[model samples]
Target: MLSGWEFIPFLTDYLGGDIHAPQEQFWFLNNFSDLVTSSFQNVCGGDVLNGRSLGILLIITLFVGWLFVKNDATNLLIYVLGVTLALCSTTFIDWTSLSHNELIMNTIGNIQFPFRLVPYAGLFLSVIASFVICNIIDGITSNNYKQILVIISFVLISVCGYFGTVQPALDRITQNVSEKYLKKTESKQTIPDDVVIDKYNYNAIFDYLTQTGETDYYSEKAYNNATSIINNIVYVNGKESKLIAEYKPNKIIYMIHAQKGDKIDLPVIAYKLTSVSDNGKKVKFNQSKRGTVEILARTNVNRIEVSYKPIVLYYVMMFIALLSWFGVIFYQVKNVKNRLIY
Candidate 1:
């Protein structure tokens, strides 16, 4: 039940007891191969919108609790937990998803992070839409047929939605990797990433990697040996002309590689370096191992944007609940007055 907060920071890093972890960079660089190699590549390979789903569930439960349970911490905890769930949700959205598609899929590039979780909110909206339709049906029709129809609408729409958007994304990830290698014109000429390594001092090797963000210009084996401390790492863009690290003892390198002609609003992860390489270029450092702490972000444009679908959806649900409660109060008042002797 309480296994989610493994990556949460030590609270001092954040402004309001909230820490920041860039998502797009964290997953792709740290665990891209997991998705690329997985048989069920989509859901089984990486992450799906569990946080969004939980957040939606959390909000719906809280609102329903208002109708059923007394106002108390027990119910309030559910609301708080929903908010927490969304925060965790951002970490895994761009992962492989057999449930979502044939390969892996990521969110749109141009949108902000706060809006990144829109699909989840849209989903929450659909859920709310179904609920609204159900209640309207019950109040106006009161027939068994109406209830059955409402049930169908709820299931058909929600399931179709998540699966439809997700499945295609998986297909793209699977294809992109294969199609890319197939078209490589410099098949023999291109620099190989793996080669024999010479035994040398490990510190010098680490220093070389620290400066250039790589061990060798034409060898993945060298790069892998140096970054053995990390669990996994993958190239964000296909390849680059020897990536170099600007500087740092500990820093997160945020980079995005979008499709050709695709729209993107890459977030400003760094203020020091103004312009970076785009899709045709290599701007972000690829991490071989997952960091002790990780930030999850969408690989978009120049502004930092994290998806907040759960939060927004909860707010909408809460607002509806407040209005409903007010209506209930007014109805009670009118009944009391009509019964009083005049």
Candidate 2:
């Protein structure tokens, strides 16, 4: 990504302040109880609290405290990491407050949202929870209380999860399906049937539009444009022209019916690494006012191809990542086998 500095936005810095954490989400003594009570809010998308779920979470949290008393090396490390990451996820200084400090606004502001670190915090907490459960089960033969506690923990987790996250999420899905797909509304009818309803289509990030003097990337025109459509219609000299676009995941081929010397504006973004070939010969392209690629028809070209060619370093890093994954899996499997044999 660093190699293709011209194509990728926000490589060196990001100045998007609107995406930062809000004042309401800041951690404070008065709202500290929300750490447990807001479990339902995280899942179901509302601030509504479930008393039973809150009680279950609070019990689990107190159970986590027992790990500190036990003082196992691995458990202690996991506990410290989890607590530190959780605190990092909270907004110590609100977005508005951070705007005053230029140093913080430039450094920490690049993260976009501090809450994005919450997943890492949750991952460590989950590992600790699993360790605690396994330890309790292993000690159950010596102490009957361990067995009782294990049973209670399982029961409470299941019940609370069903009411707090599972059931509410299911309800939300049903509501969305009915409102979005099932219900026949005038607004929904205007949407084209060919438009692909995928995660990429709804990408909220508009760092690409930053070059176009657009500050609020969330605006409708900034993200959604003619290029976003599956069947991208070509425009020649600001007029609609007959063209057939064959779209693929990484490449696009446009068969345009244009004369020589016609300036063609293709419905695709002009990235530095984007290679354009007219007929069989490679041709240079320029960025139009709207940041779309503009190609000049040196000859009456029927076929034009566009594809991304990433730097060699990207492939090298990808290969290293695959090797690392294999190495980790092999070590883990070997360790498990050794334990079993012993």
Candidate 3:
């Protein structure tokens, strides 16, 4: 969560608040069938589950109820959690109407997808389903009835796996192959020399500091007219300076020569988590209307580094998580050693 655009506060607000509505949709009765089998379909689409999938879910629900009756506490808890997750994930609420409420929209609407929690629900339900099948098989004393139950379970599982997972994955792979290779080769589209690629085309929310417009390159006029501290150009002593930029995941390094009073403009956008250093020493930086970073050289600056560094609290939490994971692994290893010795 501390990585990438998640660390940017304004970007988070723009994504969770401004653009969450289009992702919202209501769940239907057939959605439960889709949820149980992990059926892939657009939430906003009018697609309905087939009768066979629906029937499978109905049988699974019946088994869940039976497990509850038999006082199978573990499976019952798992089933309830699955249902709760399904209900909360854009399923029950009329978010289309609730989208007007700022608090509600920011909090619950942050999910951005109706099916965000559906996969977890499906996982829990799958565990319960397997447990229920085992229980049913164990309870059957007659060999003939046990064999029939086993065959039925196997058939149902195979059908569900094929339709829910394998077929959808195959279809996606075929579509991607056709679109990426076949379609491009067939069309033979050539790029125009005048056409400049917009790196921030897909990243609209990151431009909150700029608020240039819906489009990145098209909104340059707005940022250009604004009184931003930085410009799109690098300067040394009031003269434009050329620099080489090395991009990385967490940081960007610039190889530029600068004397005192030189204002260097970095290509990277300015965010709350962004930090700038001149020759490994922290430097004060200003944000442009276009969200670019500008720094005045105090000394002869050779190498400048701009990085996205999360706060101390993020590192503390990460340390705790790693420690906890190691503890669990050590305990499990000890238990395995003891079992082997016995």
Candidate 4:
């Protein structure tokens, strides 16, 4: 119910396509959106709250206290006010030296807009308003009349909330879904290979790389250099230079039948953690000008293995996390068994 009233202004703004920053004239609590926008100064004009909505909110907030003075609603009102004030405190603080206070600035900056506190304020006001109305209804002389009044009040509140909040949200969702579907149908062109997809699409890939410690050597310069080298590579006896063995996520063995003093370039990015072995003997690997891993294959050497070794710390941390989860599960199981037996 509180959310419904709090979001009504936002819903109206969204519907009207007037969701931009408030104008200079509408800044400074003169409008609802201005009241919600972060920052003390309203240099960028955007949406502002409606005057009628503000008036209604103010009247309810002021008048509800009078109704709740004789009841326990006062305590709840105070608690609500305290919480709301705490959430809003950053808005009034001097942020001119925010650069010096990185932690404080980051915490507040995460909020995106200070005006978000307005919904919270509206929420608390709604709570107080509900309490006031209920308290007034409780004071009726007849029990039957009081019950009827309560039921009527609940129905009215529910109806108002549904229409004011849920309906607008549902309408917006339907509209967005329809528009997106239309766009999908209209789009026919293929995405270019060079075009980067949204980061969220590849977040899992990044997470996997991080977990395996494979992201340490991810340098853009190295990748670009490797691509250039691969493009200009000349192969001798290409049929003999083939992958001999493959292991997903870590190791690859290649048979490079290169003559004496022949440099065989492997199809892998050059990294410090990569270990190269020639014909079962450890060999020093060099990087191509393009940054791809390459090795000098001796005349007798027939096979080469390129293995990626992750840092030991990655395994240690994984083991520790696993152990902690196991310990927690054991403790919970033991407690549950004890309770059941007792």
Q: Is 2 or 3 the stronger prediction by lDDT?
A: 2
- Runs off by more than 4 Å, candidate 3: 1-75, 90-93, 100-103, 119-245, 255-259, 267-273, 279-282, 286-292, 298-302, 311-313, 330-342
Cα lDDT of model 2 by residue, 208-251, tens digit: 23222232232232134534322345778888654546656677
**C-alpha local distance difference test of each model:** 0.35, 0.55, 0.52, 0.47
Tens digits of lDDT, candidate 4, 30-88 = 23333433222221221223211222433345344544654566656564573454245
Each candidate structure's count of clashing pairs: 43, 0, 0, 13
**Candidate 4 to truth, TM:** 0.34
Top TM-score: which candidate number? Answer: 2
Looking at candidate 1, what is the lDDT of residue 5? 30
Quickly count the clashes in candidate 2. 0
lDDT (Cα, 0-100) at 263 in candidate 4: 71
How high is the lDDT of residue 226 in model 3?
A: 32
TM-score of each: 0.25, 0.58, 0.50, 0.34
Query: Considering summed lDDT, which 10 consecutive residues are worst modelled in model 4?
Result: 18-27
Cα displacement (angstroms), candidate 3, residue 216, comes to 14
For candidate 4, the lDDT comes to 0.47
